[model samples]
Target: MSSIAIKFGIGKSTVSDIVKSKAKLEEFQTEIDDGDCTKKPRVVRKSDFPELDRAVYLWFVHQRCKGTPISGPLLSAKALQLYPRLYPDNPADFKAGTGWLRRFKDRHGVRCLSLQGESLSAAMMDVEPFREKFLKLVEEQGLTRHQMFNCDESGLYWKLMPNKTLVTSREKEAKAFKKPKDRVTIMACANASGSIKLPLLFIHKALNPRCFKHIDKNDLPVHYYAQKSSWMDSYIFKEWFLNRFVPLCRNALREKGLPERALLVLDNSPAHPDIVSNIYRWIDNMSLLATQHYIRYPTHGSGCS
Candidate 1:
Protein backbone atom coordinates (compact mmCIF):
# COMPACT_ATOMS: atom_id res chain seq x y z
CA MET A 1 0.00 0.00 0.00
CA SER A 2 2.84 2.41 0.82
CA SER A 3 4.72 1.58 -2.44
CA ILE A 4 1.49 1.97 -4.51
CA ALA A 5 0.73 5.38 -2.82
CA ILE A 6 4.31 6.57 -3.54
CA LYS A 7 4.04 5.43 -7.21
CA PHE A 8 0.72 7.36 -7.64
CA GLY A 9 2.11 10.45 -5.78
CA ILE A 10 -0.62 10.19 -3.09
CA GLY A 11 -0.39 10.07 0.73
CA LYS A 12 -0.68 6.66 2.42
CA SER A 13 -3.79 7.87 4.33
CA THR A 14 -5.47 8.93 1.04
CA VAL A 15 -4.85 5.44 -0.43
CA SER A 16 -6.33 3.83 2.69
CA ASP A 17 -9.34 6.20 2.51
CA ILE A 18 -9.89 5.34 -1.19
CA VAL A 19 -9.66 1.59 -0.36
CA LYS A 20 -12.27 2.08 2.37
CA SER A 21 -14.61 3.96 -0.05
CA LYS A 22 -14.04 1.54 -2.94
CA ALA A 23 -17.48 -0.07 -2.68
CA LYS A 24 -19.29 3.31 -2.69
CA LEU A 25 -17.23 4.54 -5.67
CA GLU A 26 -18.11 1.40 -7.64
CA GLU A 27 -21.79 1.78 -6.81
CA PHE A 28 -21.64 5.45 -7.94
CA GLN A 29 -20.03 4.36 -11.23
CA THR A 30 -22.80 1.79 -11.70
CA GLU A 31 -25.44 4.54 -11.12
CA ILE A 32 -23.80 6.76 -13.74
CA ASP A 33 -23.58 3.89 -16.23
CA ASP A 34 -27.22 2.93 -15.75
CA GLY A 35 -28.32 6.59 -16.45
CA ASP A 36 -29.78 6.84 -12.94
CA CYS A 37 -27.34 9.58 -12.02
CA THR A 38 -25.38 12.17 -14.05
CA LYS A 39 -22.29 12.02 -11.78
CA LYS A 40 -22.80 15.72 -10.90
CA PRO A 41 -23.04 15.24 -7.11
CA ARG A 42 -20.41 13.11 -5.33
CA VAL A 43 -22.76 11.86 -2.62
CA VAL A 44 -26.42 10.79 -2.92
CA ARG A 45 -28.38 11.62 0.21
CA LYS A 46 -31.67 9.72 0.34
CA SER A 47 -34.83 11.56 1.38
CA ASP A 48 -37.00 10.33 4.25
CA PHE A 49 -40.09 10.50 2.05
CA PRO A 50 -38.87 10.14 -1.53
CA GLU A 51 -42.33 9.92 -3.14
CA LEU A 52 -43.55 13.08 -1.36
CA ASP A 53 -40.46 15.05 -2.30
CA ARG A 54 -40.74 13.81 -5.91
CA ALA A 55 -44.40 14.87 -6.13
CA VAL A 56 -43.55 18.37 -4.90
CA TYR A 57 -40.64 18.59 -7.35
CA LEU A 58 -42.90 17.52 -10.24
CA TRP A 59 -45.47 20.14 -9.26
CA PHE A 60 -42.75 22.76 -9.05
CA VAL A 61 -41.39 21.78 -12.48
CA HIS A 62 -44.89 21.86 -13.99
CA GLN A 63 -45.51 25.35 -12.64
CA ARG A 64 -42.13 26.55 -13.90
CA CYS A 65 -42.81 25.09 -17.39
CA LYS A 66 -46.04 27.12 -17.50
CA GLY A 67 -44.02 30.28 -16.72
CA THR A 68 -45.53 30.66 -13.27
CA PRO A 69 -43.29 32.50 -10.80
CA ILE A 70 -42.56 30.45 -7.68
CA SER A 71 -41.43 31.77 -4.31
CA GLY A 72 -40.13 30.04 -1.17
CA PRO A 73 -43.43 30.39 0.70
CA LEU A 74 -45.39 29.08 -2.28
CA LEU A 75 -43.15 26.02 -2.53
CA SER A 76 -43.47 25.29 1.18
CA ALA A 77 -47.24 25.72 1.06
CA LYS A 78 -47.46 23.32 -1.88
CA ALA A 79 -45.36 20.73 -0.03
CA LEU A 80 -47.65 20.94 2.98
CA GLN A 81 -50.69 20.60 0.75
CA LEU A 82 -49.38 17.45 -0.97
CA TYR A 83 -47.84 15.79 2.11
CA PRO A 84 -51.13 14.44 3.49
CA ARG A 85 -52.05 12.86 0.14
CA LEU A 86 -48.66 11.18 -0.44
CA TYR A 87 -48.37 9.54 3.00
CA PRO A 88 -51.93 8.66 4.00
CA ASP A 89 -51.15 5.86 6.50
CA ASN A 90 -47.91 7.17 7.98
CA PRO A 91 -48.65 9.54 10.89
CA ALA A 92 -45.32 11.30 10.61
CA ASP A 93 -44.61 14.79 11.82
CA PHE A 94 -43.68 16.63 8.61
CA LYS A 95 -43.32 20.39 8.66
CA ALA A 96 -42.19 21.97 5.39
CA GLY A 97 -40.27 24.79 7.02
CA THR A 98 -37.09 26.77 6.16
CA GLY A 99 -34.79 23.79 6.79
CA TRP A 100 -36.82 21.49 4.54
CA LEU A 101 -36.92 24.17 1.85
CA ARG A 102 -33.13 24.57 1.93
CA ARG A 103 -32.62 20.79 1.63
CA PHE A 104 -35.21 20.55 -1.18
CA LYS A 105 -33.45 23.23 -3.23
CA ASP A 106 -30.09 21.49 -2.79
CA ARG A 107 -31.55 18.07 -3.63
CA HIS A 108 -33.12 19.33 -6.89
CA GLY A 109 -30.25 21.66 -7.88
CA VAL A 110 -32.70 24.60 -7.89
CA ARG A 111 -31.50 28.18 -7.46
CA CYS A 112 -33.48 31.41 -7.31
CA LEU A 113 -32.35 33.94 -9.90
CA SER A 114 -33.74 36.78 -11.95
CA LEU A 115 -34.49 35.09 -15.30
CA GLN A 116 -35.25 38.11 -17.47
CA GLY A 117 -34.52 41.70 -16.51
CA GLU A 118 -31.85 43.68 -14.64
CA SER A 119 -33.97 45.43 -12.00
CA LEU A 120 -30.87 46.27 -9.92
CA SER A 121 -29.80 48.69 -12.65
CA ALA A 122 -32.67 51.03 -11.72
CA ALA A 123 -31.70 54.46 -10.29
CA MET A 124 -32.59 53.78 -6.64
CA MET A 125 -31.57 57.34 -5.61
CA ASP A 126 -34.53 58.80 -7.53
CA VAL A 127 -36.97 56.49 -5.72
CA GLU A 128 -36.77 58.30 -2.36
CA PRO A 129 -37.06 61.75 -3.98
CA PHE A 130 -40.06 60.60 -6.01
CA ARG A 131 -41.75 59.21 -2.88
CA GLU A 132 -41.18 62.49 -0.97
CA LYS A 133 -42.51 64.60 -3.83
CA PHE A 134 -45.55 62.35 -4.26
CA LEU A 135 -46.38 62.51 -0.56
CA LYS A 136 -46.02 66.29 -0.45
CA LEU A 137 -48.18 66.72 -3.54
CA VAL A 138 -50.86 64.42 -2.07
CA GLU A 139 -50.92 66.46 1.17
CA GLU A 140 -51.05 69.82 -0.67
CA GLN A 141 -53.80 68.59 -3.03
CA GLY A 142 -55.77 67.02 -0.14
CA LEU A 143 -56.02 63.74 -2.07
CA THR A 144 -57.56 61.03 0.04
CA ARG A 145 -56.65 57.37 -0.42
CA HIS A 146 -59.92 56.65 -2.18
CA GLN A 147 -59.53 59.68 -4.47
CA MET A 148 -56.13 58.58 -5.79
CA PHE A 149 -55.88 55.77 -8.40
CA ASN A 150 -53.05 53.86 -10.10
CA CYS A 151 -53.34 51.76 -13.27
CA ASP A 152 -50.96 49.41 -15.09
CA GLU A 153 -51.11 46.87 -17.92
CA SER A 154 -49.60 43.38 -18.05
CA GLY A 155 -49.47 40.70 -20.75
CA LEU A 156 -50.79 37.16 -20.23
CA TYR A 157 -49.56 34.30 -22.37
CA TRP A 158 -52.68 32.15 -22.47
CA LYS A 159 -51.30 29.53 -24.86
CA LEU A 160 -47.87 28.96 -23.31
CA MET A 161 -46.31 25.44 -23.47
CA PRO A 162 -43.16 23.92 -21.96
CA ASN A 163 -40.05 24.05 -24.14
CA LYS A 164 -38.15 21.29 -22.35
CA THR A 165 -38.80 17.67 -21.34
CA LEU A 166 -37.02 14.57 -20.04
CA VAL A 167 -36.57 11.71 -22.45
CA THR A 168 -35.54 8.04 -22.14
CA SER A 169 -32.33 6.67 -23.65
CA ARG A 170 -34.34 4.55 -26.09
CA GLU A 171 -35.68 7.65 -27.89
CA LYS A 172 -33.39 9.02 -30.61
CA GLU A 173 -34.51 12.64 -30.06
CA ALA A 174 -37.37 14.69 -28.61
CA LYS A 175 -39.47 16.13 -31.43
CA ALA A 176 -40.12 19.86 -31.42
CA PHE A 177 -43.54 21.34 -32.07
CA LYS A 178 -44.51 24.92 -32.91
CA LYS A 179 -45.70 26.62 -29.75
CA PRO A 180 -48.83 28.79 -29.76
CA LYS A 181 -48.00 32.48 -29.35
CA ASP A 182 -51.49 33.71 -28.39
CA ARG A 183 -51.47 36.41 -25.72
CA VAL A 184 -53.62 39.24 -24.33
CA THR A 185 -52.98 42.48 -22.47
CA ILE A 186 -55.02 43.22 -19.36
CA MET A 187 -55.15 46.67 -17.77
CA ALA A 188 -56.24 46.87 -14.13
CA CYS A 189 -56.81 49.91 -11.90
CA ALA A 190 -57.64 50.41 -8.25
CA ASN A 191 -57.51 53.08 -5.53
CA ALA A 192 -54.80 53.14 -2.85
CA SER A 193 -57.38 52.20 -0.18
CA GLY A 194 -58.65 49.26 -2.31
CA SER A 195 -62.17 50.67 -1.98
CA ILE A 196 -62.65 51.13 -5.69
CA LYS A 197 -61.65 48.57 -8.35
CA LEU A 198 -62.38 49.70 -11.88
CA PRO A 199 -63.49 47.24 -14.52
CA LEU A 200 -60.55 45.58 -16.32
CA LEU A 201 -59.53 46.66 -19.83
CA PHE A 202 -58.94 43.51 -21.93
CA ILE A 203 -57.19 43.90 -25.28
CA HIS A 204 -57.03 41.23 -27.99
CA LYS A 205 -55.85 41.08 -31.56
CA ALA A 206 -59.23 40.07 -33.02
CA LEU A 207 -62.13 42.52 -33.17
CA ASN A 208 -64.72 39.77 -32.71
CA PRO A 209 -63.56 36.38 -31.49
CA ARG A 210 -65.50 33.34 -32.74
CA CYS A 211 -66.39 32.35 -29.17
CA PHE A 212 -68.08 35.73 -28.61
CA LYS A 213 -69.94 35.70 -31.93
CA HIS A 214 -73.36 35.16 -30.32
CA ILE A 215 -72.60 37.26 -27.25
CA ASP A 216 -72.95 41.01 -26.99
CA LYS A 217 -69.81 43.12 -26.46
CA ASN A 218 -71.79 45.54 -24.26
CA ASP A 219 -72.64 42.73 -21.83
CA LEU A 220 -69.00 41.73 -21.36
CA PRO A 221 -67.49 42.14 -17.87
CA VAL A 222 -64.39 43.95 -19.09
CA HIS A 223 -63.86 47.02 -21.27
CA TYR A 224 -62.78 45.04 -24.34
CA TYR A 225 -60.80 46.57 -27.20
CA ALA A 226 -58.97 45.28 -30.27
CA GLN A 227 -55.45 46.08 -31.46
CA LYS A 228 -53.38 44.52 -34.23
CA SER A 229 -50.66 43.58 -31.77
CA SER A 230 -53.12 42.89 -28.90
CA TRP A 231 -51.37 45.50 -26.79
CA MET A 232 -52.14 48.87 -25.22
CA ASP A 233 -51.80 51.90 -27.52
CA SER A 234 -52.45 55.64 -27.22
CA TYR A 235 -55.78 55.46 -29.08
CA ILE A 236 -57.10 52.53 -27.00
CA PHE A 237 -56.08 54.12 -23.68
CA LYS A 238 -57.61 57.50 -24.61
CA GLU A 239 -60.89 55.85 -25.59
CA TRP A 240 -61.04 53.76 -22.38
CA PHE A 241 -60.12 56.74 -20.18
CA LEU A 242 -62.81 58.99 -21.63
CA ASN A 243 -65.62 56.47 -22.22
CA ARG A 244 -65.17 53.76 -19.52
CA PHE A 245 -63.01 55.04 -16.64
CA VAL A 246 -64.38 58.59 -16.42
CA PRO A 247 -68.02 57.46 -16.41
CA LEU A 248 -67.40 54.74 -13.82
CA CYS A 249 -65.56 57.14 -11.50
CA ARG A 250 -68.25 59.79 -11.92
CA ASN A 251 -71.05 57.35 -11.07
CA ALA A 252 -69.21 55.80 -8.09
CA LEU A 253 -68.42 59.25 -6.66
CA ARG A 254 -72.02 60.35 -7.04
CA GLU A 255 -73.25 57.25 -5.22
CA LYS A 256 -70.78 57.72 -2.34
CA GLY A 257 -71.41 61.50 -2.11
CA LEU A 258 -67.69 62.14 -2.71
CA PRO A 259 -66.34 64.99 -4.86
CA GLU A 260 -66.38 64.45 -8.66
CA ARG A 261 -62.66 65.30 -8.80
CA ALA A 262 -60.04 62.49 -8.72
CA LEU A 263 -56.29 62.28 -9.09
CA LEU A 264 -55.21 59.64 -11.64
CA VAL A 265 -51.66 58.39 -10.99
CA LEU A 266 -50.07 57.02 -14.17
CA ASP A 267 -46.62 55.69 -14.97
CA ASN A 268 -44.71 56.96 -18.01
CA SER A 269 -45.86 54.28 -20.46
CA PRO A 270 -45.58 54.89 -24.20
CA ALA A 271 -49.26 53.93 -24.60
CA HIS A 272 -50.21 56.83 -22.31
CA PRO A 273 -50.81 60.06 -24.20
CA ASP A 274 -48.00 62.64 -23.91
CA ILE A 275 -48.83 64.76 -20.82
CA VAL A 276 -46.36 67.50 -21.81
CA SER A 277 -48.40 68.20 -24.97
CA ASN A 278 -51.92 69.72 -25.02
CA ILE A 279 -53.39 66.50 -26.49
CA TYR A 280 -54.58 65.04 -23.14
CA ARG A 281 -56.11 68.04 -21.37
CA TRP A 282 -59.27 66.08 -20.54
CA ILE A 283 -57.97 65.52 -16.98
CA ASP A 284 -58.48 69.24 -16.25
CA ASN A 285 -61.34 69.88 -18.68
CA MET A 286 -63.48 66.94 -17.58
CA SER A 287 -63.37 67.99 -13.87
CA LEU A 288 -60.77 65.35 -12.95
CA LEU A 289 -58.51 67.07 -10.38
CA ALA A 290 -55.08 66.22 -11.78
CA THR A 291 -53.01 63.58 -13.60
CA GLN A 292 -50.02 62.65 -11.50
CA HIS A 293 -47.35 61.39 -13.90
CA TYR A 294 -44.63 59.11 -12.47
CA ILE A 295 -41.67 59.79 -14.70
CA ARG A 296 -38.80 57.29 -14.93
CA TYR A 297 -35.48 59.00 -14.36
CA PRO A 298 -33.16 59.14 -17.35
CA THR A 299 -30.16 56.96 -16.38
CA HIS A 300 -27.56 54.49 -17.70
CA GLY A 301 -29.98 51.63 -17.06
CA SER A 302 -33.59 51.65 -18.23
CA GLY A 303 -35.72 53.30 -15.54
CA CYS A 304 -38.53 51.36 -13.84
CA SER A 305 -41.96 52.93 -13.31
Candidate 2:
Protein backbone atom coordinates (compact mmCIF):
# COMPACT_ATOMS: atom_id res chain seq x y z
CA MET A 1 0.00 0.00 0.00
CA SER A 2 2.93 2.39 0.83
CA SER A 3 4.61 1.45 -2.45
CA ILE A 4 1.37 2.12 -4.34
CA ALA A 5 0.90 5.47 -2.58
CA ILE A 6 4.52 6.49 -3.51
CA LYS A 7 4.05 5.42 -7.11
CA PHE A 8 0.56 6.95 -7.68
CA GLY A 9 1.05 10.01 -5.39
CA ILE A 10 -2.34 9.39 -3.65
CA GLY A 11 -3.12 9.13 0.10
CA LYS A 12 -2.05 5.88 1.87
CA SER A 13 -5.62 4.94 2.94
CA THR A 14 -6.95 5.52 -0.59
CA VAL A 15 -3.99 3.55 -2.04
CA SER A 16 -4.51 0.77 0.52
CA ASP A 17 -8.21 0.43 -0.52
CA ILE A 18 -7.19 0.29 -4.21
CA VAL A 19 -4.20 -2.08 -3.56
CA LYS A 20 -6.60 -4.78 -2.32
CA SER A 21 -8.64 -4.31 -5.52
CA LYS A 22 -6.29 -2.81 -8.16
CA ALA A 23 -3.28 -4.97 -9.16
CA LYS A 24 0.01 -4.47 -11.03
CA LEU A 25 -0.67 -4.62 -14.83
CA GLU A 26 1.67 -7.66 -15.08
CA GLU A 27 -0.73 -9.71 -12.87
CA PHE A 28 -3.78 -8.49 -14.84
CA GLN A 29 -2.02 -8.94 -18.22
CA THR A 30 -1.33 -12.67 -17.62
CA GLU A 31 -4.95 -13.94 -17.23
CA ILE A 32 -8.20 -13.68 -15.12
CA ASP A 33 -6.58 -16.09 -12.66
CA ASP A 34 -8.07 -15.43 -9.14
CA GLY A 35 -9.43 -11.83 -8.92
CA ASP A 36 -13.14 -10.84 -8.68
CA CYS A 37 -13.67 -8.12 -11.40
CA THR A 38 -17.48 -7.73 -11.66
CA LYS A 39 -18.19 -5.69 -8.43
CA LYS A 40 -20.53 -2.66 -8.62
CA PRO A 41 -18.96 0.81 -8.54
CA ARG A 42 -18.94 2.72 -5.21
CA VAL A 43 -21.76 5.25 -4.94
CA VAL A 44 -20.54 8.85 -4.62
CA ARG A 45 -23.77 10.55 -3.54
CA LYS A 46 -22.88 14.07 -4.79
CA SER A 47 -22.54 12.70 -8.35
CA ASP A 48 -24.92 9.69 -8.02
CA PHE A 49 -28.61 10.81 -8.19
CA PRO A 50 -28.53 14.60 -7.89
CA GLU A 51 -32.09 15.16 -9.16
CA LEU A 52 -33.78 12.72 -6.75
CA ASP A 53 -31.86 13.76 -3.59
CA ARG A 54 -32.23 17.49 -4.36
CA ALA A 55 -36.02 17.10 -4.63
CA VAL A 56 -36.12 15.54 -1.15
CA TYR A 57 -33.93 18.32 0.25
CA LEU A 58 -36.04 21.02 -1.39
CA TRP A 59 -39.26 19.51 0.04
CA PHE A 60 -37.73 19.54 3.53
CA VAL A 61 -36.67 23.20 3.14
CA HIS A 62 -40.14 24.18 1.90
CA GLN A 63 -41.82 22.43 4.83
CA ARG A 64 -39.52 24.19 7.31
CA CYS A 65 -40.22 27.58 5.75
CA LYS A 66 -43.98 26.93 6.10
CA GLY A 67 -43.53 25.78 9.75
CA THR A 68 -44.77 22.27 8.96
CA PRO A 69 -43.65 19.50 11.29
CA ILE A 70 -41.54 17.03 9.32
CA SER A 71 -40.86 13.67 10.98
CA GLY A 72 -38.52 10.88 9.72
CA PRO A 73 -41.37 8.65 8.51
CA LEU A 74 -42.97 11.63 6.78
CA LEU A 75 -39.78 12.45 4.85
CA SER A 76 -39.26 8.77 3.97
CA ALA A 77 -42.80 8.49 2.57
CA LYS A 78 -42.29 11.75 0.67
CA ALA A 79 -39.08 10.43 -0.89
CA LEU A 80 -40.91 7.31 -2.07
CA GLN A 81 -43.67 9.46 -3.56
CA LEU A 82 -41.20 11.80 -5.32
CA TYR A 83 -39.24 8.95 -6.96
CA PRO A 84 -41.88 7.88 -9.52
CA ARG A 85 -42.77 11.47 -10.36
CA LEU A 86 -39.11 12.54 -10.73
CA TYR A 87 -38.01 9.55 -12.76
CA PRO A 88 -40.77 8.07 -14.91
CA ASP A 89 -38.99 5.63 -17.27
CA ASN A 90 -36.08 4.73 -14.99
CA PRO A 91 -37.34 3.72 -11.53
CA ALA A 92 -34.31 3.62 -9.21
CA ASP A 93 -34.10 0.68 -6.77
CA PHE A 94 -33.73 2.94 -3.73
CA LYS A 95 -34.99 2.13 -0.25
CA ALA A 96 -35.73 5.34 1.67
CA GLY A 97 -35.50 3.52 4.98
CA THR A 98 -34.12 4.60 8.38
CA GLY A 99 -30.51 4.06 7.29
CA TRP A 100 -30.99 6.19 4.15
CA LEU A 101 -32.78 8.95 6.09
CA ARG A 102 -30.01 9.16 8.75
CA ARG A 103 -27.26 9.24 6.10
CA PHE A 104 -29.15 11.92 4.20
CA LYS A 105 -29.46 14.08 7.31
CA ASP A 106 -25.75 13.72 8.11
CA ARG A 107 -24.79 14.46 4.51
CA HIS A 108 -26.93 17.64 4.40
CA GLY A 109 -26.18 18.77 7.97
CA VAL A 110 -29.91 18.70 8.85
CA ARG A 111 -30.58 19.24 12.57
CA CYS A 112 -33.43 17.46 14.42
CA LEU A 113 -34.00 19.26 17.71
CA SER A 114 -37.00 20.24 19.82
CA LEU A 115 -38.69 23.25 18.19
CA GLN A 116 -40.24 26.17 20.12
CA GLY A 117 -42.59 28.63 18.48
CA GLU A 118 -41.16 32.01 19.47
CA SER A 119 -42.27 35.16 17.74
CA LEU A 120 -40.38 35.49 14.45
CA SER A 121 -40.38 39.27 14.77
CA ALA A 122 -38.52 39.14 18.10
CA ALA A 123 -34.87 40.15 17.88
CA MET A 124 -31.85 38.50 19.55
CA MET A 125 -31.09 41.67 21.57
CA ASP A 126 -34.60 41.66 23.14
CA VAL A 127 -34.02 38.26 24.81
CA GLU A 128 -31.12 39.11 27.16
CA PRO A 129 -32.94 42.02 28.86
CA PHE A 130 -36.03 39.84 29.47
CA ARG A 131 -33.85 37.08 30.91
CA GLU A 132 -32.08 39.53 33.27
CA LYS A 133 -35.39 41.00 34.49
CA PHE A 134 -36.87 37.54 35.13
CA LEU A 135 -33.79 36.40 37.07
CA LYS A 136 -33.81 39.63 39.13
CA LEU A 137 -37.48 39.10 40.06
CA VAL A 138 -36.72 35.50 41.11
CA GLU A 139 -33.77 36.62 43.26
CA GLU A 140 -35.68 39.48 44.92
CA GLN A 141 -38.83 37.47 45.62
CA GLY A 142 -36.82 34.43 46.94
CA LEU A 143 -39.06 32.12 44.94
CA THR A 144 -38.61 28.36 45.23
CA ARG A 145 -39.35 25.59 42.73
CA HIS A 146 -42.89 25.07 44.05
CA GLN A 147 -43.60 28.82 44.14
CA MET A 148 -42.43 29.50 40.57
CA PHE A 149 -45.01 28.67 37.91
CA ASN A 150 -45.56 29.30 34.17
CA CYS A 151 -48.91 29.33 32.46
CA ASP A 152 -49.27 28.81 28.70
CA GLU A 153 -52.32 28.95 26.49
CA SER A 154 -52.85 26.71 23.47
CA GLY A 155 -55.65 25.68 21.13
CA LEU A 156 -56.30 21.97 20.62
CA TYR A 157 -58.39 20.45 17.88
CA TRP A 158 -59.19 17.26 19.78
CA LYS A 159 -61.03 15.35 17.04
CA LEU A 160 -58.75 16.12 14.10
CA MET A 161 -56.60 13.78 11.98
CA PRO A 162 -53.36 14.44 10.08
CA ASN A 163 -53.83 15.39 6.43
CA LYS A 164 -52.00 12.45 4.86
CA THR A 165 -52.08 8.66 5.35
CA LEU A 166 -50.30 5.75 3.65
CA VAL A 167 -52.38 3.53 1.37
CA THR A 168 -51.23 0.02 0.41
CA SER A 169 -53.25 -0.98 -2.68
CA ARG A 170 -55.95 0.93 -4.60
CA GLU A 171 -57.70 2.63 -1.68
CA LYS A 172 -60.34 5.34 -1.63
CA GLU A 173 -60.08 8.64 0.25
CA ALA A 174 -62.38 9.30 3.19
CA LYS A 175 -65.83 10.84 2.52
CA ALA A 176 -65.67 14.67 2.25
CA PHE A 177 -62.04 14.80 3.40
CA LYS A 178 -61.32 18.15 5.03
CA LYS A 179 -59.01 19.55 7.69
CA PRO A 180 -60.85 20.15 11.00
CA LYS A 181 -60.99 23.52 12.78
CA ASP A 182 -62.81 22.29 15.91
CA ARG A 183 -60.80 23.79 18.76
CA VAL A 184 -60.79 24.76 22.45
CA THR A 185 -58.37 27.17 24.14
CA ILE A 186 -56.72 25.68 27.23
CA MET A 187 -54.78 27.40 30.03
CA ALA A 188 -52.22 25.06 31.63
CA CYS A 189 -50.13 25.86 34.71
CA ALA A 190 -47.32 23.86 36.29
CA ASN A 191 -44.30 24.47 38.49
CA ALA A 192 -40.65 23.75 37.70
CA SER A 193 -40.59 20.48 39.73
CA GLY A 194 -43.55 19.02 37.74
CA SER A 195 -44.96 17.49 40.95
CA ILE A 196 -48.34 19.03 40.31
CA LYS A 197 -50.54 19.16 37.21
CA LEU A 198 -53.27 21.74 37.90
CA PRO A 199 -56.79 21.24 36.61
CA LEU A 200 -56.68 22.44 32.98
CA LEU A 201 -59.09 25.30 32.27
CA PHE A 202 -60.65 24.40 28.93
CA ILE A 203 -62.58 27.30 27.38
CA HIS A 204 -65.08 25.74 25.02
CA LYS A 205 -67.39 27.52 22.50
CA ALA A 206 -70.69 26.22 23.88
CA LEU A 207 -71.96 27.98 27.03
CA ASN A 208 -74.61 25.35 27.74
CA PRO A 209 -74.38 22.63 25.13
CA ARG A 210 -76.96 19.81 24.79
CA CYS A 211 -74.22 17.14 25.13
CA PHE A 212 -73.65 17.90 28.85
CA LYS A 213 -77.30 17.37 29.87
CA HIS A 214 -76.64 13.98 31.51
CA ILE A 215 -72.95 14.63 32.52
CA ASP A 216 -72.27 16.30 35.85
CA LYS A 217 -70.04 19.41 35.58
CA ASN A 218 -68.42 18.82 38.99
CA ASP A 219 -67.39 15.27 38.08
CA LEU A 220 -65.66 16.35 34.82
CA PRO A 221 -61.91 15.73 34.35
CA VAL A 222 -61.01 19.26 33.30
CA HIS A 223 -62.19 22.54 34.86
CA TYR A 224 -64.44 23.54 31.95
CA TYR A 225 -64.87 27.33 31.45
CA ALA A 226 -67.69 28.21 29.09
CA GLN A 227 -67.73 31.10 26.57
CA LYS A 228 -69.57 31.77 23.31
CA SER A 229 -66.37 32.71 21.43
CA SER A 230 -64.10 30.32 23.38
CA TRP A 231 -61.50 33.03 23.98
CA MET A 232 -59.74 34.58 26.96
CA ASP A 233 -61.15 38.05 27.55
CA SER A 234 -60.34 40.49 30.40
CA TYR A 235 -63.35 39.35 32.44
CA ILE A 236 -62.70 35.61 31.97
CA PHE A 237 -58.98 36.02 32.53
CA LYS A 238 -59.50 37.98 35.78
CA GLU A 239 -62.02 35.40 37.00
CA TRP A 240 -59.60 32.51 36.28
CA PHE A 241 -56.69 34.24 38.02
CA LEU A 242 -58.75 35.39 41.04
CA ASN A 243 -61.09 32.41 41.63
CA ARG A 244 -59.44 29.21 40.34
CA PHE A 245 -55.70 29.93 40.12
CA VAL A 246 -54.97 31.46 43.56
CA PRO A 247 -56.65 28.71 45.65
CA LEU A 248 -55.03 25.93 43.61
CA CYS A 249 -51.53 27.41 43.86
CA ARG A 250 -51.95 28.04 47.60
CA ASN A 251 -53.15 24.47 48.21
CA ALA A 252 -50.31 23.03 46.13
CA LEU A 253 -47.71 25.06 48.04
CA ARG A 254 -49.26 24.12 51.40
CA GLU A 255 -49.19 20.41 50.44
CA LYS A 256 -45.50 20.75 49.55
CA GLY A 257 -44.78 22.73 52.78
CA LEU A 258 -43.78 25.86 50.86
CA PRO A 259 -44.91 29.51 51.05
CA GLU A 260 -48.53 30.49 50.24
CA ARG A 261 -47.10 33.04 47.78
CA ALA A 262 -46.60 31.98 44.12
CA LEU A 263 -45.15 33.83 41.12
CA LEU A 264 -47.54 33.24 38.20
CA VAL A 265 -45.77 34.00 34.94
CA LEU A 266 -48.06 35.10 32.13
CA ASP A 267 -47.39 36.70 28.78
CA ASN A 268 -48.43 40.33 28.24
CA SER A 269 -51.77 40.23 26.50
CA PRO A 270 -54.93 42.37 26.17
CA ALA A 271 -56.91 39.94 28.36
CA HIS A 272 -54.78 40.78 31.43
CA PRO A 273 -56.13 43.92 33.10
CA ASP A 274 -54.02 46.55 34.88
CA ILE A 275 -56.46 47.35 37.75
CA VAL A 276 -59.32 45.63 39.55
CA SER A 277 -62.49 47.83 39.52
CA ASN A 278 -63.13 48.86 43.17
CA ILE A 279 -60.39 47.02 45.07
CA TYR A 280 -56.88 48.06 46.06
CA ARG A 281 -53.95 46.19 44.48
CA TRP A 282 -51.58 43.88 46.41
CA ILE A 283 -52.88 43.29 50.04
CA ASP A 284 -56.64 43.01 49.41
CA ASN A 285 -58.12 41.74 52.71
CA MET A 286 -61.01 39.37 52.04
CA SER A 287 -62.22 38.85 55.68
CA LEU A 288 -65.86 38.44 54.55
CA LEU A 289 -64.83 35.53 52.32
CA ALA A 290 -62.64 32.72 53.71
CA THR A 291 -60.30 32.63 50.65
CA GLN A 292 -57.03 34.55 50.36
CA HIS A 293 -57.29 37.62 48.13
CA TYR A 294 -53.65 38.02 47.12
CA ILE A 295 -53.95 37.01 43.47
CA ARG A 296 -51.58 39.51 41.85
CA TYR A 297 -51.33 40.33 38.12
CA PRO A 298 -48.93 42.56 36.23
CA THR A 299 -50.08 46.10 35.55
CA HIS A 300 -49.91 47.72 32.07
CA GLY A 301 -47.22 50.15 33.30
CA SER A 302 -45.09 47.38 34.87
CA GLY A 303 -45.27 45.44 31.54
CA CYS A 304 -44.16 41.96 30.38
CA SER A 305 -43.23 38.90 32.47
Q: lDDT score of model 2? A: 0.65
How accurate locally is residue 45 in candidate 2, as Cα lDDT from 0 to 100? 36
Question: For residues 43-136, what per-residue lDDT tens digits would candidate 2 score against the true structure?
Answer: 2234145687779888888977875667788888888898888778767777788888876665465656555555433445656776776677
Q: Distance (Å) between predicted and true CA of 112, model 1? A: 4.4
TM-score of each: 0.54, 0.55
Give residue 26's lDDT in candidate 2 (0 to 100).
Answer: 34
Model 1 Cα lDDT, one tens digit per residue, 94-198: 899898987777666666754464344455676787778778867976778887778888888988877678999999989988887899999999888898899
Best by TM-score: 2
User: What lDDT score is found at residue 108 in candidate 1?
Assistant: 69
In Å, residue 70's CA in model 2 sits off its true spot by: 14
